[model samples]
Target chain A: MPDSSMPAARASTLIVVPAYNEAATLGDVIRALRADWPWVVVIDDGSTDRTAAIGEAAGAEVVSHTVNRGQGAALQTGFRYGLDRGARQLVTFDADGQHSSADLERLLEPVVSGRVDVALGSRFLEVKSDIPVLRKMLLKSAVVFTRVTSGLRITDTHNGLRALSRAAVEQLDLRADRMAHASEILDQIASHRMRYIEVPVHVRYTRHSRAKGQNTLDAFRVLIDYLLARVFR
Target chain B: MNAFQILGISLSSCFAILVVLGVVRRRLRPLPGAAWAALWIAAAIAIAEPDLTVVVARALGIQRGADLIFYLAILGMFIGFFVMYVRMRHLDEGLTAVVRRLAIVEARHRIEETARGEHEASERSPTD
Candidate 1:
């Protein structure tokens, strides 16, 4: 548990974990987060399992969707909840235990210190993690796609680990209710001209995480969804 | 008229009448109802005078009347699909908003309940 005498800034920072049927790993993820962060909210995306129960048992606030609305909607719900509770900073972390709580402070530093409105985690920044060959290729391709489309020049386009200042939180309005929200966030960052930076973070691709993660084909679907959204909007 | 033309015209006329009745009874808006009626009427005319389409097709530089109808049908289907896709996307957004609001409200209630429980527990405890 986080010490009660922790600084107000750390205490006010809300870590939002968007989960869908993550009963196998949510408990450990929340427990690890709660050790350093006081405010941890798990958005259970209509998991028909023990996800919500595990989250509650792990001493984290659990917000549940009545039906599956995808990870994008779940994160938006978490953002609204954190904002309403007067959180000074919000961090989006995955529920698959791929993210490390130890790296969270570094990820939140720029946002908390008011140096940047958004801090994106990039696994490619330091090349510390043993990334799978195929997954690495996919992520690199996504980086190029994001650069061409949003002109952000980011190294990682879809890393779920990120920190947002309150101002950035209020400025972002996510309409993509699925994986495409990652691209949408970058698009908004470019359009809004919000200050942002990338922080090196390690991603653990466990068998469970890899199994739960997006397939190679899903990248095309996300691209189509993103392009169509741009065209339609 | 041929038997197929007679049947096609009869069906189109019935659908056009239904569309007009729908608008009159306030079941559909006037503009959409009018569009539906126009489509049915056009179908009836094409069925009644098949040679007219050949003339129109030639003026449009199309080879055959049947080819013209097929092309028009394909174009119309594409337009219909586009409209439906846009409408479905809007509906999805609306649903996401509703679900997000509900989740936030329920989480707030849960937070309040937990806080109340803790406060009561602390009040009942002896000072260290």
Candidate 2:
């Protein structure tokens, strides 16, 4: 449990959950996060369902977009909200319940201790995660792609679970506005020369999460978006 | 002049006049409007003297005027699409910014409201 006596401590760490039409799992996710972290903000990215209502009911501060921006846009909104509220550390957690609240403490350890600017969760670092075969193959391909493009040696390229220090958060300029933001983030990290670490984390790939996850064809779109951004930038 | 040449030249001339009128009325910006006018006038010239295209194509190492026109049309289309895509991306980024600002402001208001309600509720109740 976080120390509630020190309000500054609570204010320093913020959990940002970017939710899009995950009304079924958002409430539970927020509630679970609120157990350990008091400052939880949910970016309801134009969900047609009751995502915002559920998030608010679960005791999370909910900010809602009027239109359906992609997950990358939602994450950027959450980052801005956290920064505006004077948060020193921001953690991005998936709303689809694939990411566990338990791993958050470990994921945030390096950043909170001022050891590294970012902590990226990697399921491939350890063999504990039971990823589907096709998904695993796709993720491996993405890892190779990131390594070649960004020159960053990391096991996972598309993990949503990450902890960023204030400096890292302020330096990152996320413009992909879609799944391509994952690669974009890594590209920026490499270019900015921010110190980063990879922490082994377990990912629960349930039926619901799998359904919400990206398919094979999205890899190509993400590649195109990343390449176009590079070329234009 | 052939029938097709007369018809094409007339249509292109009408478009060039419209473009000029748009520029004079300030309905279009100077640079882009000038570009449109130049394009229409060039089309008129190409239609009036198809042999000119053949000469230009030969200078460019192309065999036929029709082939040159086809390649130029495709290239122009690609450039047009690229420009539109860049503009669309800028618009998307702007929209995202506006949406993000609204969401943050609304969330702040909601938080303040909740805090005020809690304070009022505490005041209405007896202190321990």
Candidate 3:
């Protein structure tokens, strides 16, 4: 039975964090995301380390897989889990502890207000994310690629923090298995003609995060992957 | 005895030799495409000369040459479909997860951006 008294369906949010091998960072990130929103989910994708155990201890809804399927697969699990738990809006956060959970409130405001179907956290749109110079250049290229492909005017394309509404989540099919899937999601969103916005997102430049992000060689590889996803898909 | 029969024999022999070479080179990965191709060629030759199928099937102790080829070929196709289905599923699972995480990363980044600006401000100017 549909309730006629309900207002235009006020949206609730869940944070989905994908933990690869960041056992050391999982506890802090989960703790922070949960303090603001109780609905914090962590998907531990085939970590040879203690990634799953740490997330579980951090009071997150943990999903673990035995085989390593890549970041894209881990994120898919978190999305389905969050949606099943009655999350009206789903936000994707990194498990590397580079992102601040405090900004989630600002990120959620646009979506909850019904201003956009999707809201992305942009590291380059505002002040610098303290990203390395080479990584910064690579991200700029990724932004251009996404702008051209997705037809979105956002400044940062690869920024990890993004929010999606329930309808948007149901419509999206995030099936790319590797890094390029990041680019693919924008393509899907644009193709579906969903409204989206980019908000200033802050990323901490931890030594470890820098190591995990772009170097000269890795930047080249990311560029190759971004271009190839369109050509191959 | 017929021109068609001679042509059938020649094509079958050529194809079989090529498939055998593929198998020997280790390029053959038990694909059903090759199996189905083999079956069609064998059937074509058998049609050209029915006695040829009987001779081959009997040599392998099969009831009928058509029976033997049909069963083997059917099994091959089932295996191929199974492999293809599994590969498709693997791709689906991988893609779904990445896109979902992307949304999380998007949120977290926004949260972080505002948080850091606040942090910098707090340090620079004390609030009342």
Using Cα atoms, each model's DockQ against the true complex is 0.88, 0.89, 0.10
**Candidate 2's residue-wise lDDT over A174-213, tens digit each?**
8888888899889989999999999999899989999999
TM-score of chain B of 1: 0.91
- For candidate 2, write residues B8-107 as lDDT tens digits: 9899999989988998999988899999989999899998888999999999999999999999999999999999999998899899999999999998
lDDT of 1 by residue, A1-233 (tens): 22358887788899999999999999999999888788888999999999999999998988899999988889889889888988889999999999999999999998989999999999989858878898889999999998988899989899999999989989888878888899999999999999999999999999999998888899898888888878766
Candidate 2, which segments miss by more than 4 Å at Cα? A1-11, B2-4, B122-128
Where model 3 places Cα greater than 4 Å from the true spot, the runs are A1-11, A220-233, B1-128
lDDT value, residue B110 of candidate 1: 74
lDDT tens per residue, model 3, A1-233: 11234333322577888777988788888887666566677777778898878887887766665566667666766777666657788899988878898788788788888889999898877656677777778888777877877787778878789988888888876555656668878888889999998888799988778767657786566566656555545
TM-score of chain B of each: 0.91, 0.88, 0.50
Error of 2 at A8 (Å): 4.8
Q: Which portions of model 1 miss their true places by more than 4 Å?
A: A1-4, B119-128
Using DockQ as the measure, name the better of candidate 2 and candidate 3. Answer: 2
**Best-performing candidate as measured by lDDT:** 1
RMSD to native for every prediction? 2.2, 2.4, 14.3
If ranked by lDDT, best first, what sequence of candidates would result? 1, 2, 3
Best by TM-score: 1
For candidate 3, give the docking quality class from DockQ: incorrect
